[model samples]
Target: MSSSRSRRVEYDRFIPFRSAMDMDYARFALTRPSRPQRDGSRESPSSVAYQKLLDDCILKNRSRILAFKTAPEAPASKLPQFDEPIRPQKKQQRRIPKEPERVLVIRGLLDDNVLNLLDWGSNNVLAIGLEDAVYLWDAANESTKLLQPAEDRGPITCIRWSPDCAVLAVAYGNSDLALIDPATGHVVDGMEDENQAPVLSLAWRSNSILTVGRFDGTVVDYDFRKDDMFICFYNGHRRGVCSLKWSGLSGRYLASGGHDKLVHIWDACMPVSRHRPRQRQWLHRISSHTSIVKAVDWCPTRSNLLASGGGCNDHCVKFWNTINGACLNSIDAGSEVCALLWDKNKSELLTSHGSPNNQLTLWNYPSMTRVAEVSGHSSRVLSLAGSPLGGVVASAAADETVRLGLLQHRYTSDPKIELEKWCQMGYNADTF
Candidate 1:
């Protein structure tokens, strides 16, 4: 076979061009003039056919090589033009329902520092300070107004608002006792006796008020309309009384706890005709706490239940039954229980701690179990109160910051899962 005709098969299997030099050289060699055709003789038909075949093979092979090398020149199909679909972030909201705004008002910032506070019914909050001033806090608007008399005595240590929320009784230094109207800020009556050193606590039941002094461990009861001031004296505590609480369920009965580590229950019932009301009888005294009792409160829902804390530096919380004055249980809070409060619903016991560390602990009431420990204050925690209608809790500290927080509880509903599935379709947790 002729050399040119035989080369056609080789062109069909052309090698791919790898470099620019190889490609250019191959094209140049194919186009260059063939060797002097056999002494310039006129080529025969077979030679012409062979020469045409060789040229055609060279052209086809060169085209295939060039096509292989330059194939990338054409613009790529440009990957489907996709924009990563934007994902929307989910907004988080509180789990509980929104509640009304209830505020705590600062009545008077006393110079000697305010030590005690009492809520007179649902309308008024009583605060006593070292400036010989008695402050009546308007609970509705969270504001404070003074209610001191013209003959203002010494700094008040104890204050009690009548069950009717109409009058206030103040117990102060120099063994003085006075009754003042909270609304008009006027003193209706005043009495002084040298029976006790200084009154530390005051409690009111019906129309009579209960007062306890540091000089004697006496719980003195006094009536407003009586000519002579004297009620039955509770001498069960060997040391001065520190705190007192009257049961709202049975206004005629009360509870008192003091430094003697004893809690006494009393019953004050007098005939409606008695001009000078008689004394209340001491029903029982339960000695349970190892140290001084700082504060005592009757459970709002449970008629016979009471809670106490303070001075028990080792174990700071305790629950008891007022019926028999028997302690139900105790909890070790690792500090002095400066203040103890039962929530508005009486389902929780909030305890405040003093120096070294400031903390607020929420305990399941009566059961004596802790539910949560809140820590954000740099100073001692002084007071704690919860909203009546909401899950919000307010705590006041010596640090001057009143913290407000929601009591968070986890709840699951069937709708939540269905909604999440509909929203998340093909996505997962990692997509967030």
Candidate 2:
């Protein structure tokens, strides 16, 4: 019986354990001898001690054994519970301001087919030419005074205030161009014989040299200081020259529009200079307008950019690259474009329309998006001039009225306001 018991112990020790619990039980059984199995016999003290040790080991390592067991599945919940309610984020809406402020209006001042009847002087003065009279309106005090010529030539045809604001160039229907002092309204100088046709347009190339466009379709550069003598003549347009503008940015290129539906860009030098004998005075003969091309303005920010607007038959504004003579952009302005003005402080274009619309439109440059429109004139709007302070714009219409309003951008230094203005004009906020 002793031999059989020893063999049983060896067989149990040789058998491989399947789990950690089986290994612990085998260790306890092998460390102590087996107890005798008699009817109603109590367990030996050693067996009881071994059983307690095994229980203690399992109790100490209960977590370790369960870590290797498969985890139980979690029950799914239909709705999630939160400490607070969830809210969706709201999108920001863009805001656009209303029409510009109307500061003042002077009625019964303009009543003709004249194109450039209104201009703002550098001295904060506004000049308006009515039939047989030239009025100087001081914007600072809102005062009006008639500018009496030295001699009664004829009804006033054209009037241009000099860049310095001290002198005014006045043209009469009798083919006479006179330089008058604005303070006294007296003629400082006069020229009559050089231009037989009535001077319809006048632009100062310098303090002494003035460019005159005649009703006979001739463009002449004259030195007003030297007895108003002619320097050179540029002949391109078939009909009368109605608009003349010397580029203030370069002072090297001249843009002139005529009643013949032609827009001519001219170089400032002589038509037949010895160095450039083949190079004529006319640089680019832009025949884009189907009707009269009167409104012409050089971009204040871009030196090589030029903007010109057409008449009733062709209600379009075309932007040109002066260097290469390429039409960069064209916008169909719905109505007859009468005048174009660039904002001095921003990259925006203001256009005055006539006839059907008779409105003033502010546009985003290059994009050609209409920002705002002003409408009050009963007749066609004729001219537009920006204030020297860069905040106000004055518009004249054939309804015999002149209106002053604020610009879309009041201050250039405020970027937040400008960004909001652009977004309101249907532009993406990231564009700027």
Candidate 3:
């Protein structure tokens, strides 16, 4: 059986790569007539007959593909023609075009407030918490809040405005959060931390849903439009949450950084019932920082990209691909990262620092280069907020001043700048 199997294999006669020639030859060989000669005599055909058959096969197989091809200009054809190519667009500038124009500077508030409590609303209003009181600074008319927080409502720890500007959510040191009508200064609705922990951070996913982070690392979300209010909670951090930001392609992802040296990424699209809501697990728990993780923000354009910074012990700014929780890049920012903000229309990032530097550093994303650094505060910057218009930034610091900078990166016609010039002149007349 082995000998017969060995003999069954047929050796190839066709040349490598030129399989078409092999196919041509097989067609000619198979078509030859098998003549049964009389008297069991087998004989070769006449040379003329063979030549006649060869001629017939050649004529049958002939086609344009078998014809010769040659370049008529290169000793053959003319040179190929090409249309004029379009030039690529110029790259966006890495640095802020000019130094930040000091727009509106609010001076002389008492020091000692939560470091993660400055937010600029889409309604052109800025909310800032300064020790025991919440202040709303209206940028449109240069008028301060006629509806201010009462002095006895404990110390205001966090202030966030809804996307629609319908209400402002203020969290007190006593773990109570109130949603107040921005125009009327009336507390319309409120919630409290389940554990009675101090609410340190707040992020709004939509005008109706508010995400809260507490001193005990508890994270919860509430839909203000509903009766039950409580939607879901996230757990992972062992210490107080320091910052919270809601960003993603669908704006359903919640990124929270805490004092436990952890960053928890949660998703609200997982679905939670209002009446029987329970603990919702975190999507990703990033433990890349050696110290407390504080400053955190999502890339405005890239949904899966997130950036976070560490406290003084680890002063490193790290970028993460939130889709897979991978550390994409890291920068050793020489000072503590107190807060972070990203330009909405550009790939630029601004970070507020603490300790010796106390400087605000602007960076070009992906490239991770320091574009500009401005020393605007006497002490560490407490928090940062970028205007909804995409060019200005508001930073509050321990210096008890809120400085608005018209980054003026690429906007030649930003109305915020015209408004800034007006506020710069009138800022000193009023105080908060």
Local distance difference test values of all predictions, in order: 0.60, 0.75, 0.75
Q: What's the TM-score of every candidate structure?
A: 0.60, 0.70, 0.72
State the lDDT of candidate 2 residue by residue for 371-394, as single tens digits. Answer: 888787778888888888676787
Question: Lowest lDDT 10-mer window, candidate 3?
Answer: 63-72
Candidate 2 clash pair list: none
* Worst window of 10 by summed lDDT in candidate 2: 423-432
Give the C-alpha miss distance for residue 413 in model 1, angstroms.
21
Candidate 1 minimal-lDDT segment of 10 residues: 423-432
Report the candidate with higher lDDT, 1 versus 3: 3
Candidate 3 per-residue lDDT, tens place, 111-199, comes to 54234668888898888776666678777676677446656566778888888888888888767889899878899999755458888
Instruction: Evaluate model 1: give its lDDT.
Output: 0.60
Q: After superposing candidate 1, which stretches have Cα over 4 Å from the reference?
A: 1-115, 118-121, 124-130, 148-152, 209-214, 268-281, 382-432
Per-residue lDDT over 125-209 for candidate 1, one digit per residue giving the tens place of the 0 to 100 score: 5343434575554434545676654454566666666666666777676778777777787777867767657777777656665
